[model samples]
Target: MEKPRKTAIFSQVPTLEEPRIDANILIRLLQVAIDRDFEAAEVALLKTLIQDPCLNFQAVADKTGYQMYYLRGQVGPRLWADFTEVFGRSYGAEIGKRNFGDFIHCFLEKLSLMPNSFLQQDLEQHQIAQIFEPGEGEWAIAPSESWFYGRSKELDSLGKLLSQYRLVTLIGDVGVGKTALAARWTERFGAKSFDRVIWKSIAHAPEPDILLNELLQEFEVKELPQKLSEKMSVLMQIIKRQRCLIVLDSAESLIRTTAITALDPYTSPDYGRMIRFFAEEPHQSSLLFISRRRFNDVLRLSRANRAAATMRLEGLQPKEAQRIFEAHGLKNSSDWQRLIQIYAGNPQYLISISEYIQTVFSGSVQEFLRCDTVIVPDIVCQEYITQIQEINAEHRALLFHLAALKDPVHFDQLVVNLATSMKSQSALIKALNDLTEMNLVEKQQNNAILFGLNPIVKKVILSFPFIGGS
Candidate 1:
């Protein structure tokens, strides 16, 4: 009798019509099978395979910008072993570059035949494992804490607010440590309190659609919708099921300071809608918005809903401000309190002032104070100038008038001071409210309500050439 011919590894499995699987679906399958995430190169290879299954290793390397040797040697062998452990040896036997798509299609078809509960359970378990893994889920795109000092009360307050509310807005002046506080809180309690911690800064002013798409991808959504409405719905579903803490820093970039409207036209309406949904919808997640000025919608929603809250961050306490001076190696501890008071305990201003003292006054706080003039750093001045430019001419005039004040003045006094520049009392009141919202003017409630600029802010305004003498 003739010897029976051995069947080839690729020929043993019956060929089925290759179904077109979404790249994201294939990526999810691969992630599940391997019990881990893919590096950029591996993900690129898989995405490329969806377009052309018959491409060789060289072709994949050319498209993906990965070396052919790296793909064929290190990547190929590891994938083969990983697939073999998940699928049987027959399915994993001949998974080369040319037949990679065939393998994926066959595996997916087999997966479709498996019980739905089994697949769901596996996926759930995988996600749970990822969540519980130590130091796993923090995506800290915000700046790190260089030298964080006391905010014990604020930190505790944040914890309590996050527990009770789904949306919390941390509003403050430009350099009042809002970003630092958010970052530090995330560093301390993020892993323990939530499944994932995501930090994003919109300082560059990304479009709402682009931002939503990026966030959906971050959550590993299998299919993203083309419409913003659908995307918000899907995101709400994910947050409802999974405990998440998301921080949007530099939120003022999207808000309008000149008007009571929550956002400027540069930002899409969808962004505001998304914020409303997060605030209104019941979910087990928290969205923290850090902005210099509070949004009108946030204010409105916060009043109506217990799930939304806003915290107006102020300058650090005298004790906390002392630490910054100490870290800068400044002398004259006796005068530290005076220095802190002058700077209003603003962390960034203190840090900049401390460094200036260290550089110019030989680390002597007394010497720096003796100069008897508010020393606004260039960076801080530029920030103030930028903010001033965004406001209307009436608001700018009001700020300049405030800068000229010898002491906090009453509302009536402001009207008289700005009578020529602003003829309408309602417009003057509106301007004061806008400036207060921007944290540029401080409100003092003594026998009467009085408004004045922080010494540092007044100094910056007076020194600013364009508006100095106006």
Candidate 2:
């Protein structure tokens, strides 16, 4: 069998060399034009266009392993919308894939003709959109906000915090949307507000030396420092010069818990030093550290330095939480508010529980709530288990005792309950404070301050093996 030769779409155009274009810039333009993050398929299609400006959809499928049908049907229209958005209606009016090559060529030539200053001026005037250039680090694409609800007030508070402090720690429980909020804020204001923006995740607990090297490289530093101290010095210099917004996510991974004691809480020493440097050093850049718990070093530094601050993220409001259920196609029930309240308005939990309800109760919220017991989704429970295991036994015992209680209790009640396990009242108070800081416990102020566990947290604790499974 003889295969037909594939033809170049650009062959019909004039014989001129293709203009070189930075793919990252093109990708960012598409993202901003469409006001959403590009999915894997969309990214693949763009890469294919950039790699071979003359290739048709058939050739693109061969090169990128996407179905030609999908390239034309699903990916094509969306991309054309982005094109229409970035270019004009004329550029995207045609539906033929053949025009893709022309689009690329035209876009590249247009980019070349514009001066850098003109582009900046246009960006500032909001005539043309631009985003932060990728710096040295793992630059994560900001997640889509299609289903993101609420946090308007938090966003405003975050902006004020960044303006006032050089280092801001966003503390929240697992699945409480800390990372989402940070990414959203950065997406909204990072380019306009700072010279450079970099996102790094310590989810794998990368050592301080490795993290520093990665950050330094993001700034295009060619001469690598061999010593940690030297790396810190070089990074401080770069940050002082360039107004950078560096986000370190999953920062709780940097805290060491193996040797944690009632009196002495331990954080990774190098990580602590780096945090202290960011908190204490005079720099134009800002660092946003997102963690499940407030690091002891951050606590101490925040007390002494006005340049450091911490914001604890709570769950969505009732109305906002209802949107999750509505989006999930769950039936409206009077108990929807009850469900949201029990879950502490946590988006991840609500999403997970909604799926459970869909499968187990046919998407009937009332039916799901009929069981009367708070059903902590397995995924949520697993996350709680991982976090609880990392805390000291004293903290765990305090949590367990709180979980056993029927209602919120005062501090004096907790002191009496855990007196035998804890050495002194001071130790018990510290445990309460630490747990509260971690977002694992809640503090309610009425006639007097009362402490309690979130419903989900209490449910998880009751099921613990040591607690003999409620």
Candidate 3:
């Protein structure tokens, strides 16, 4: 015996008494949400998808007489893909009938009221209110402050990115304020925009499994996924459920020193995969990467996607640097300008000098400038020295030559200057590229790729006794 054929005449319809609204209204809203062409059959299919008490696609296919192939392959994917595009993430598995009710509920509540809307109830304000308050997952976020300055532009830019993009990398030299900027921005814009803000600092570049397990714990996942891919999927599911802001500070700790200049993925395999997953997957959440160096994979992705971006923090402006001086009660505002120029307005350097003046010179800005020809915080100088020692002698020589130059030099000029003393043009180019990535050398604004050393970096190099004093 064969099974009997089912037709639209036999399809079941429900009244308002059974549920909240007519199935037709839901089908119309969904069509508007997805911006799709729905014929009578597709409408019937959607009615089954939403109104069926079982919430089972396969069972509905059997009862409605529509081929499972069309329902599963053609209509289902289109609907979900549109949802992901509109909502910026997926709420359920790609193939499953699970989460249908939650999806309906969220859409009904979250979406703007459409014309001819027949919603029985609007979205609850409590759901929107919950995102602004700190939740269980906020233990990892850093505290915000009131004294942060000169980063309003950066904060606004990050605000736009978090709304539109999934991954953002904040790159700068150490003490250039990457961490502070990220933390401050989170407090200003992120605190209200996201439901959970989790901050983690990579102290020693732990293995992927360890980090993954830790993150799962933070999410309070009781039954952890066995595989890395499964873990990523589960994490993304949580992101879809609630707005999340994940801040990973000191991201450069995970990249091998030698690999920093290489045009390859980050040296840490697990972290590399994480970056790729964040960039490629659809999620409403944003990941903030604060690092001294840029991840090549992230740079590549950001270049290709406006939704992913990199914000390279530079030195503070003169007016902004003045606040640091005033906070220390330092006098001689004009002399402070000279110090700012020498340090290129780096807050760490200014603070260190201010403390030194307060203790030894009675906050005399002139006396501080008179004694220090190469002014920098001792810690910053040590860091610069360490970074310089990482490269070979040829790269070191190129950096010395760059520091010695009065203005930015073109590649050909650089080659000519180093013809007898330095390595070949290719080696010099490679070294220059490496130095630029490390934030020691910067390209000048010209059609030709002219390169120059950072002012503070040059001062530090000149101050090296063995390198011949300025």
Candidate 4:
């Protein structure tokens, strides 16, 4: 699989490869107020508009206003009638009562700030001013629109986890769609039930003290006591009263190709304090810990042993993959199967390749079946990898090799190839197990280890100049 020619096009000086979008396509994001339950959609729409005012289209604004006034939160048919009247054009039958969800989705999508050369020629060239830059919305209630595709089961599982326990551990690898699942769950379930949902990514492994301080900041509490014990006391008191759902992302120190380094310094004793705070304090609270590492590191503290439900995401199924393509407006049953065979259910990779085939490659879904192209490792994966500073060169090198091999390799084969990298067999097993927990790889009975290789990943890997590039 060679890297997608599109990536190469992007790499070349922009003047060299043509851009795909117009310069003046910055229509404001739709701000149709919805039932308060749809807060996530409203906030996201508002932020998109504020950040990319160039997308502010008069027609879109009018429709959004109508939605705020009349239609239920999601897009509906009446909006279509308004669209025809305002824009002098109408598409999609029965506009008065069509799915507002789809309309709002398409509307918001068109507002993306894609600054490409091709787009420049299509529209006008004006800068999106930063004076009113958007801020990160409160813990994400709605998963990004991509999750709206085909993942109902995963979202259902998440709702169950939330119902059973206060602490949930969303364990999955890069691009496995853990965050998306949580977002969907929070939107559908939280909107109807929970009092509040707070999303906080523990950016990196900083000293426990510094990390704890930031956690307190999320609560808007200033001037903490210097003594660790006092701060811990204050934190617990505040948490006990609120019915809040907390997501602590990347709680461990398992660095990967996509994780960023943090600046936290927790002494062994303080580490105990930190663990106790999460596990023992906040007796009536619920929390979720999302990370790439397996449970051993988190569970080792003993505090987490009595709490926390776990949800590990897997690759998509063929049916779900097909559903995603259809939602994206593709209608080829045969090609859908081909896509599943190639991508093996990795959502981000699937979406990336799909985008390439659509907007960049002339909208022919079949082109993907006929060609081999590598895409970026997904924004999620790339962001996760940048957080790892402790993953040294040797371990990283071993992972690179392991990623190259097909899964279910016997332990003997792995050791023959990677034993030299580690000091002993125990260490190797731990390392491999860590990857498994990360959802980056899998292991099974009979001492066999498997690596993550969905169709899109394999395609991307093969596209690279080197072998096993994914």
Candidate 2 clash pair list: 136-218
| Local error of candidate 2 at residue 430 (angstroms) | 1.4
lDDT of 2 by residue, 1-470 (tens): 32212211121222226455456556655565555677788888888776654444555676789887798689978877655555444232232343455455544444444555544432321233222222244243333222357899999999888878889999988887887788778766877788887777777888788999899987879989999999999999998988888888888777665454333443456776777888899999899889987866666777886768999898999988987777556786677998888888888788778767765676788988788778777867887888788777777878888888899999888878888889999888877877887788999998999999988889888887553222
Better of 2 and 3 by TM-score: 2
Better of 1 and 4 by lDDT: 1
Put down candidate 1 lDDT per residue, 1-470, tens digits, no spaces: 32212211121222244444567655665665456777787788778776666444555777899986797788877776665455433342334543455455545544543444544443532332232122335343234434457999999998899889989999988778887788768766876898887777788778888888888987878788998888888888889999999888888888765554523532566677778888998889999988888877777887886768999888888888887776567889999999888888888788778767866776788987888988887878889888888777888888888887789999988878787999699988877877888888889997999999988788888887485334
lDDT of 3 by residue, 1-470 (tens): 32212112112223323555466756654554444557665775767766643333444566678765687678777765655455423221222333344355434433322222322333232332222233444433353322345878877877887788899888988677777677767645665899887877774677777777777777899999889888888888988888888888878777765543464445557777888887788888888888887777877888787557887888789888888777667778889888887777777777667766765676788887788666667778888887776556677778889898889998889889999766588778777877787888988776777888876788888888353322
Model 1 poorest ten-residue lDDT run: 3-12
Quick one: best lDDT, which candidate?
1
TM-score of 2: 0.69
lDDT of 2 at 331: 81
Which regions in candidate 1 have their CA more than 4 angstroms from the true location?
1-142, 259-266, 467-470
Superposed by TM-score, candidate 2 places the C-alpha of residue 445 at a distance from the truth, in angstroms, of 2.4
Q: Per-residue lDDT tens digits of candidate 4, residues 364-432? A: 677755665445555644443443224444445455665576564676676778767777777667656
Error of 4 at 134 (Å): 14
Q: Is candidate 1 or candidate 2 better by TM-score?
A: 2
Best by TM-score: 2
